[model samples]
Structures are given as structure tokens and as C-alpha cells.
Target: MDFTFSTEELLIQQMAREFAEQYLRPATRRIEKENRVPDEILAGLAGLAGLDLFGMNIPEQYGGAGAGYLSYVLAMEQIARVHCGPGLILSAHNLGLGAIANFGTDEQKARFLPKAASGEHIASFAFTEPGTGSDPKQLTTTAVRRGDEFILNGAKRFISNAGYQGPLTVFAIEAESGVPTAFIIDKFCPGYSISQPWEKLGWHGGDVVDFNLKDVVVPLDNVLGKIGDGYPILQFGIAYGKIGMNSLALGSTLAALELAVRYANERTHREQPIAKFQAIQLKVAEIAGLYESSRWLCYRLGFLANDPKSYRDFAREAALAKAVVARNAQEAARISLDVHGSYGLMQDAEIARVYRDAAMGPQIEGVLHMQQIILAGDILRKR
Candidate 1:
């Protein structure tokens, strides 16, 4: 098996690293303090001459770079290492974009993708509600047909990019069929309103909020795929979403490792560096191992995502990778914090921010235990 990245992949990875160091690294403090990414940074990420980081996975015809999933993952790792806010934004945006790309008709792609790819709009996927965390059966959202338009009513919770103007892919139960369906609707339409952003535990700049859809109108043509197809579309969107999530976690893992090693070498004990301590050495080794293992799992998942033989199998693998990588990132952050000792506890410490960011990976997308259940079910079904 060829384990090396191609030249193009390396170039994209380098470009992302440079962008993160040049732009995101300097702005990290502001982003964390303000809990918002500047519009200029977002524009640069999208409109930069050679670095269309925001549209890495979109097709070239859609005003995107079409760099494929592996390139996207590589770029995300670098972007997230400096700061996870941009990575989180891209991850959620791709979740909505992936659903449309995989399930939407040609007309739908033509209409929605160009502007989204250009970063003129940020896309969002709305499926989770206050009552239904990951369970689709408990969805309270309703969509009713009215002539050529559908009226939607529901409240979506913890939806990322909902506050932004873009196409939102929403899942709801149809009044006539009683079957769950997916619809593509514009955000901030006549009947849509969003709550103030929820102050989350980490990833501060990635805005997530609850939104109310009261008699939201969408044309029948906006129905994604077909009626009763929301389940598969949700599955596909989430499976791909895991790719971005894994990349973010892996980046956090790498950051934790680097911080631990740096702290070990720089911190002195009795005029000697802490790197001389066996305990510090062991902690650094553990963090390195976690970073390496998580890196390979994320890269493999990205490769498999490029052209999966079966999305069912792909989803299972994504679940497995996310479970391991997310846990590794959290563990790595913990170990790094231990290395930092009292300093890491300070709110402004960089390692402290990494700790909070890593803590979020296991909870978002799907909880760690939920991923375990998915893996267990897949294994038992194969048996």
C-alpha cells in the first residue's frame, strides 16, 4: 500500500499550513475572545487565488477547486491546528453541500452550489432538534404541501451556520405521506428566524444556534432526492461529515503532541529541562502515538470516502474512525494538559484552548458511545 501523499496533496497541505500560520494563527486570540471569525478571513479562505480552502471538495464546475476528500482532509488538519473555528465552519458547510451533491438533482446543484462554492453563502444541514439528538423517528418538524410550495414548521437546535445566509437542507415529516423528507430552503426566508448563538464549551468562533421555521415556504422542486429518502440522505451526509470531524480531531491531536513536546523542552526543573524527566518523556511519547494513529485513521477514512464501494460500509468505517480518533484527541489533550500542569489551567493558555477544543470532538456529530453502538451493530450484523 502506498502510504505517501501525492505531490498535489503535499502542495495543498503546505498551502493550508502557510495560510494557518500567516492568517489564522495571528487571529486566534481575537477569534477566541470575540467568538467570531472576521469576514475578511472567511473571504480570503474562499477567494484566495491559489487556495480555495473553503471549496476543496466541491466540483470545479461549481466554482470550487474540486480537490477531492483527501485534499480537503489534509487542508483541514492544518487549518484546525491553528484554530478550529474555520474548520468547524467548513465541516458543517460541507455536510449540507455533500447532501446536495449526493442526492440533489442537476438543477438543484446548478442553483445552490455556485454561490456556496464561492463562499458568497454558507450552507447548513438541519436534522437535529431539541427532542431528537440523532434519532430521526422522533422528529417533530412537519412539512405540508400547498399547491407547488411546501409549508414547513419546526425548531432545530444546535444547528451550525443557521445564522448565515445560504441554502439549508432540512429534514421533516410530510403531512400527506407521514414519511420523513428532505427539503432545500433558503435561510432567513419569510418565516425563518434564529435564536442568539449558544455559548458552547469550545470552538468558540463556530457559531451554532437554534432556529424556528414557521410556515417556511419552499417549492416542490426543492425536495431533495425523493419523498421518504431523508434517512439515506442523512446517513450519507453524516458519514461524509465524519471525515471533516475526524480531520479536526486529528489536528487537535497533533497540536496536543506538539505542545507537550515543546513544554517539556522549554520548562526547566532545577536549571534542567523537563525533557529530562522520564514521566514527561512518557507523556510526550503517548501523545505522539495518539497523533500518529489518529492521523492514519483519518487519512484512510478520507481515501475511502473519495470512492466508497458501498456507503453503508463507508458509514460504518467512518463511525469506527471517529470513535477512535475523537477519543485519542481528547486523551492527547488531557496528557498535554498534564504536561502543562498549572499553566494549562489558565484560560488564556494555548494548551488550555486545545484542551477545550479536543473535549468537543467526542460530543459533536455523534456522541462517542453512539459511535460504539454503530460499530457494534455493524460487526454483529456481519457475523
Candidate 2:
């Protein structure tokens, strides 16, 4: 696979890096303490929407940049290195938005794509129920066809972007057909309400909403793809989520790793830099190694995403990328803190926030163990 980036990807990377340093980093303290991303920053992020920073991989006809797969992931990695709120928000939005781009009808695309691409109307994915997250078959949410509308009843927990004013694409079993279907339920729909946002462990400053859909009425025009075809659509969204999450992991870890290296060199012992110490050297090496490995893995998956027939094959690749990067990102953050010694653990330190942000990567998009199981199965099948 070619490692070179096109002119567009380079521009996105540079622009995102500048945006992160100039705007996002300056507000890190406020974000970490307040756990809120201001609307202005979000709107600033929207300015890049035309560059596919938010709408990457979405076709140009729909008002996005129609970026190549690598461009999308590269933009994510750049922004994620500075802050988790925007990083995860963009990824989470794209998680369901990409599905709509791929599966929605012409009218549906025309109705939502341009606005969504411009970041005017954000989208959320509602799939994780109260007791079911990874296992969709156990979803208790059911949608019943009634006249011209589908009546939905169930609660969705840990839904990203639910607090935002936009449409949510919900996943539920169609009672009569016993087929899982994706329905776009507008925030204004009847009986559709969001519970209080959850206080998250790491990715804060953004909404993580719980959906309570009691007889939520959605028009027939809202269905994404055909009935019983939700699986592939869901999987596609998930694959992109993993892909972006992989970038999130890489971005945060690389940031921590580079900072640790600089700290080691600048910090001194016996009037000499700590870079002379082999222990510090080893930690830097480990972080570097993981970053390189994960970067290549994510890049490879970007290429895999281009082949429509490689969807399932890309599933395992996405999982592997997420699993490895998540684990390694955590390790990198820990070692980065170690390099700073007690200073890193101090509440006011920047690395402390970075550590917390890095902590979220492994847990989301399915746990690391699940990804490992998928990877193992892929290995066995190949052999």
C-alpha cells in the first residue's frame, strides 16, 4: 500500500493541527474542569466541515469534501491528539452519519446530507440498550408498524449526540418481521425524549445521552436501507467508528509519547538530562514502537475500506487496529506520566487530562477482548 498522502490529506492534517494548537489546546483547562465544549468551538469545527473533517468519506455531491479514506482518518488523528471532546464527537457523529450516506435513499440524502455535512444537523446512533451493547440480538427495543408510522418503544443508554438538536438513527427489531431495522427518529418526534446526560469517565465536555422512546412515531420515509438489512448498515457504521477510534488512540498516544521524550531530554538529574537514563529511553522506545505499528495498521484499514466487497474483512482489520491502539495508547499515557514523575499526576498538569482522555479508547467501540476474539477468528479462518 502507498504511504504517501495526497495534497488534500496534507492540507487537512496541517489545518487540523493548527486548529488544535490554536483553539482547542488553549481551552483544555476549561474543558477538563467544566466538561463542556462551547458552541463557538463546535461551530469553528463546522467551518472545517467543507474539508471533510466532519464529513469525510461522504460524497461531494452531498456537500462534503468526498475525501479518500486515509484523509478522513488523518484528520481524526490530528484533532484527537489535542482533545477528546471534538475527536470523539466527530467520530460518533460519523458513526451513524456514514451509514446514512451509504444506505439512505436519494430523497433522504438530499434532505439531510447537505445540512449534516455542514454540521448544521448532527446525527446520533442509538443502538446500545439498557442491558445490551455489543449483542444487538438481545436488543429489547421494538418497532411496530402502525398505519403510516412505526411505533418505537425502548430505552437507549450511552447514546452520543442525543443532547444535540438533530435526528437520531435508532436500531430496533421490527416486531412482525423479526428483522432489525434502522429508523431515523427526529428529536422532535412524539414520545422521543432524552434522559439526563451521563457523567462519563473520560470523554467529557460532550453529551452522552440516554434515549427514552415511548411510542415514538417515525414516518415510513425514515427507514435506512431495507427491512432486515440493518446488520450491514450497522456494521459499516461501526467499522468507521473503529477506524476513527483507532486514530483517536494514535493521536492521543503520539502526543503523550512525544511530550514524554521532550520531558526526558529537558528534565535533568545530576546536572545532566534524564535522557541519559536507559529506563527513560526504553519507555520512549515502547511508545514510539506502538505508535508506528498502530499508524500503519490504521492506514492499511483505510485502504481496505475502499473495497466494498472487503467489508467483513475490513471489520476484523478495524477491530485489530482499535484493540492494539487502545491498549498501546493507555500504555503510552502511563509511561508519559511516569516520565514527568509526580508532576504528571498533579491535578493541574496537562498530562493528567491526556491520561484520562487516553483511558477511554479501549473501553468504547467494544472492549479490547472482543476485538481480540475477532482477530483470532480471522487468523484461524485465513489459515
Q: How would you encode candidate 2's per-residue C-alpha lDDT over 69-142 as one tens digit per residue?
A: 78777877877788778777787878767888888999988887787777777778888988978887888899
lDDT of 1 by residue, 189-244 (tens): 99999999888888888899999999998999999999899888988888899998
Which residue pairs show backbone clashes in model 2? 35-205
Q: Whose TM-score is greatest here?
A: 1
lDDT of each: 0.90, 0.81
Pull out the clashing pairs in model 1. none
User: Lowest summed lDDT over 10 consecutive residues: which window, candidate 1?
Assistant: 44-53
TM-score, per-candidate, Cα-based: 0.98, 0.95
The residue-level lDDT of candidate 1 at 173 comes to 94
**Model 1 TM-score on a 0 to 1 scale:** 0.98
Q: What are the runs in model 1 whose C-alpha is more than 4 Å off?
A: 45-50
Error of 1 at 205 (Å): 0.5
